[model samples]
Target chain A: MSKHVAYTDFIDCEEDVRIRAKDQARVVALREKKGWLFRLLLGLVLIGPGVLVMIADNDAGGVITYAQTGAAYGIGFFIPALLLSGLIAYVVQEMTVRLGAVTHRGHAEMIWGRYGAFWGWFSLVDLVLANILTLITEFIGVTLGLGVFGVPHVVSAAAAIAVDVVVLLVLRYYAWERVSLWIALGNLVFIPLALMSHPHWSTVVSAFSTWRVQGGFTPAFLFIVLANFGTTIAPWMLFFQQSAVVDKGLTVRDIRHGRVDTAIGTVAMVAVAIALVILTGTLVHGMRGASNLDIQQILSVLGQRLGPVGEDLFALGLVEAGMIAAIALTASTSWAMGEAFRWPKSINMPARRAWRFYLPGLLSAVIAAAVVLIPHAPLGFLNLTVQVVASIFMPAAILFLLLLLNDAAIMGEYTNRKWQNAAAFSIVGLLVALSGVYGLTVAMPHLL
Target chain B: MKKDTLSLVARTDRMAPVELTKAQVKGWVRVVFWGLRVYIVVMIVLVAIGFARGQI
Candidate 1:
């Protein structure tokens, strides 16, 4: 009855939802026609958002915290703590997969739509502020990491910006995700560096059994532990993963694969953190009475103890961590804004089409990069505030997450079980206590 | 010309009009809400006291 247009002609379609639907149908049809290998390959291909969010959780900020943990506490208390965090990360992040699959909405959108404007604005404002502050720390990581290679801060910042722009602007969603995943893989570079340190395996093994704080539970010890906690689970992570799942067009069928992806990411994150702690613990432990050595000092000590190659590798890991976080955080900011305002949001859209959607993220990255270049910018103060701010706001983020996860009409059968709610609330309680203590330590040492 | 438009696989409207029902946070869930709220407030007040006294 009519002419048939090639599928490529559909590229110009304004609504991306149609493209996603058609693509999903095609995949489903292919699965029916093709054998098991094709389905296996499809399954492999579908697991991005979960893995990406988990790996990205071990961002620049997280790396520094891990290094400090290793340097300050040795492989004693934090070794088991890392494993605990991985579990916490998995339990918390798995909810996002179900939410995205069930609702097909970003965290910001869900909050605004269901919980009224006050909560919505609160979440959005907290997310954007934390993302921007954290992005600055990421740039700081990039600059400091590259500084090891004698790269100028400006040059490194510019290069980082260019790489993020290319990845964000030039590539479509699928390609961009692949690129980000590859960069995230670079985080594993810490493993070999840790091996190079030749840590005492028996001691590492005993750390699990002992679970003892080397310096006892002093104010400093508590701070590092809380810092590790703050970095492991952040407000940005919740926004990033939900929007990522929605953007990836993952259906309810894909939620299991999503959980597996998150689990993989959790393993990777824990392993890297453990390695960093061991490496620093072996090399720089008790240095300067182990009073929270700066990252520069930590890297320099690595150079001296493990030689130049070790330092360079550690630096490379830091740079990769920063770049990966920068990309994820920028996208997170964009997604939240897009979701909040109902803008056309998806990395698949061309620059011309989604400029407004992409603008907030780009601007955040740019400002973060610019702030790093300012002379005497009080970066330590910025870093401190980012951690403090994330800590302060984390409870609210977790509360909203629990609320949405438990909502019956929206989540239907996917709602969290009662035990899951108990676990989540327990985590929230623990985090609030840790943050409250850490906040006082920072905001007022006299109390401690 | 005949054109067939593919329907949205995961429609946004599914979540668009939904709002949390009244009985959402009954039982221990309500307790959790109150507890979490108090915990956050206590943390804030402690930090505020610290600031007021210039201990930070």
Candidate 2:
């Protein structure tokens, strides 16, 4: 018995030493593999959704809003407004990445699981309706931009729809994302367009320093400002990123990469937004006042002010913005529908495998295109409807997001830290207050 | 026989119960969750009112 006990102890000691050696070797291997360059590359690969969401958030409507703001107000108040919005967009989207990565679930699923069927159905209806309305605005942008080149609205609308379809269908997830990113880069077209305008550099700098709200904040200006804010951070962004994170197979480990991606996107969005405002502010604002300067009018003004090349560039940027945002909104619609119905919902899924998931997006594109062809359709009214619907739905979307982010059962170790909640809540409160104030302004223009 | 014993041990390990009762919702989390619920309900009511009043 004594001899047997000694032999067992010796075997156990040998096994312990072998395990320790293996563990040390693993540590060394991990350290070697996760070198800074490798990590940087990995982060780049993981950055698509956040940046895409941010850029797509700066869609056709957002571009026009920034342009109008600059043209109407010059760079006085809007430059600071854009900076504040960029901060708010980052805070809101970062929470989505965390929720998605930690839970391995889409926002819809979490809402349904935690809040029961009533709220789940409510959210689904809001997302679908809002997505459809938003998609229509994207078509409006494309058609209007094309009009600058004398292309008929029908042709441009068809082409835009076809491009979005091909992108979502032919390209797998990674390839589709790359194509979208290329198109999104076209947003930077405004930067050169702004430069061509030869904006007074000193005045631009002074605007930032003054952060002046000239004309003393009339209700009209306040309404427009709030509208601009609503455009920047819409309800669709939350749904889109959470679903994108799940589709990309991100986990808690990828949260840092996701955050970095989001930051890059936020920076790009702000740059493009500021550039668009500068383009319009320098060329059109002081001259046109707040008069009815539709997108085409802005383009014509830009052409006269900065030459034909600038006009062409501005039109192309608008087209690209509309196209990229349409693709995102379509995908967001598909994703939300798939999640709500429990259908297969990944770009990774083959068409045959996920036909149901692709159908909603396809139908929405077709319907939006059809709507553009209707005569005397009050296209502006459609755009206004999208904004108003988005405004109404924004609070509910944000509230659900906060709930999920704070749910320990869902988020596990990745629940919102204190600062994140504070920032998110502040954004929610600000949005609610702005929407309310804007509603009042619209109702009683002279009240404020 | 020894192989059978090892397989039995693995199966038994796999069948161990997870301690569900140990999981507790912290007080702050409860507050945040309820707070979010209230916020959503309030917003929904406001939106409905706005729509009814044709102000939305």
Candidate 3:
């Protein structure tokens, strides 16, 4: 129902067009280069979507989850477990890189075309639903993070949506991506905050060898473990990154750079996540059974233990986490919907030209922000349900990804190698088992 | 043709989508699909029961 009146000359064509033009230009320019330096710069330029997807995966809910993990268990088992998650995220997402580069299709379009409409609709509905639910958590992070500074929820949530609209609408894809990359770099703030706590370096290093939960195995421990794993990789990541590759005009020649981009992002995500865990583990771990403290309580402890500067940094990091994830999630929803419907889907498209592509994404954000502003909305219950739905949808998403990767007709020479398939299937297997157990635990808390 | 024009032309002619009939997709693929269906169905049922029991 929204309309755009004023016209701007900032946008001319869809991002796909702009990116393809840029892709050719880069190739032509690279042909003359003979040094390692230019090659490195080119690799960095190709890094956008990969890094954005991974960092955004560590969203608002993810920050709180990591904080809780540290508070409850300290820097023991999860230090190693989190590193393993980064590798799993890379393995699963790397397939999307190849899939997009080869086929020039988003994840939803691939499922629709290759698997037929039944499964296609299933995946689409799942993705759109999960994207909306996840965005609500991101908004919750946005509102609550700002709430620390006494900013009202209405103002913060509305401002977050406004920032998204301007970013998506005003800048063309190339410029928009550059701006987002800057925001993603903000996620690193947790690193300095963790360092501020001056965690015991030897003890932190020893965690790899010590690898055991501080508390013995219990229903609560399993729930937290599953929660960490669930946040590590979500279905939107697959759709967002593939569509991003296609939009970025990454061809077979750039696949190496894509892998490097994904690897760097994996390192960055794990480091930040580890940093947050260490921060809480150091300051809040022993205080009145830190496992029981919520993020607000965790923040209070950070203030008391490390000073107001540390508390403010934690709050700001939460804000960054929510903002970056919302940016990526908005794009994922738009891109998946556009691909499924075969609409003109590109960030470079002008407002009028791609409104259908843009509307649903904006609407979803609006709804999420609105829900968060409602009084006594049972956000805790909503948060648990969000994970439950994502847990249910994740298996199907991975199954389709595996099938599409294995398909010779579409993927051609880019079809998954045997070792890659083994690694991917192993991750999928673990995810399925954990999700099933997690679901049952939710349904029957007594099951565990 | 100039490289720019040629690239533009290439971008215009998009690739056809990949589609497969049930007959073309078989063996383990079929079995995996069935297993996923059964898994999703059971999970949905369990979730529904849990919700109905007000166990969120």
> How many steric clashes between backbone atoms does each model show?
1, 1, 0
lDDT order of candidates, top first: 3, 1, 2
Clashing residue pairs in candidate 2 (N, C-alpha, C atoms within 3 angstroms):
A71-A285
lDDT of 1 by residue, A161-248 (tens): 9998889999887889889999999999999999998889999999988888765777777777788888889989989999988877
The reply for model 2, stretches above 4 Å from the true place, is A1-37, A288-291, B1-56
What's the distance in Å from true for residue A93, model 2?
0.3
**What DockQ does each prediction reach against the true complex?**
0.24, 0.09, 0.32
Cand. 3 Cα-lDDT: 0.85
- Model 3 alpha-carbon miss at residue A138, Å: 0.6
Q: In terms of lDDT, which candidate is stronger, 1 or 2?
A: 1
Q: Which candidate is the best by DockQ?
A: 3
The RMSD (Cα, Å) of candidate 1 is: 4.2
Better of 1 and 3 by DockQ: 3
TM-score of chain A of each: 0.95, 0.91, 0.95
Q: Which stretches of candidate 3 lie over 4 Å from their true place?
A: A1-19, B1-23
Query: Model 1, residue A51: what's the lDDT?
Result: 79
On residues A183-279, what C-alpha lDDT tens digit does candidate 2 reach at each position?
Answer: 8888888888888888898988887788887677776688678877988898889989988876765656567878999999999999889888888
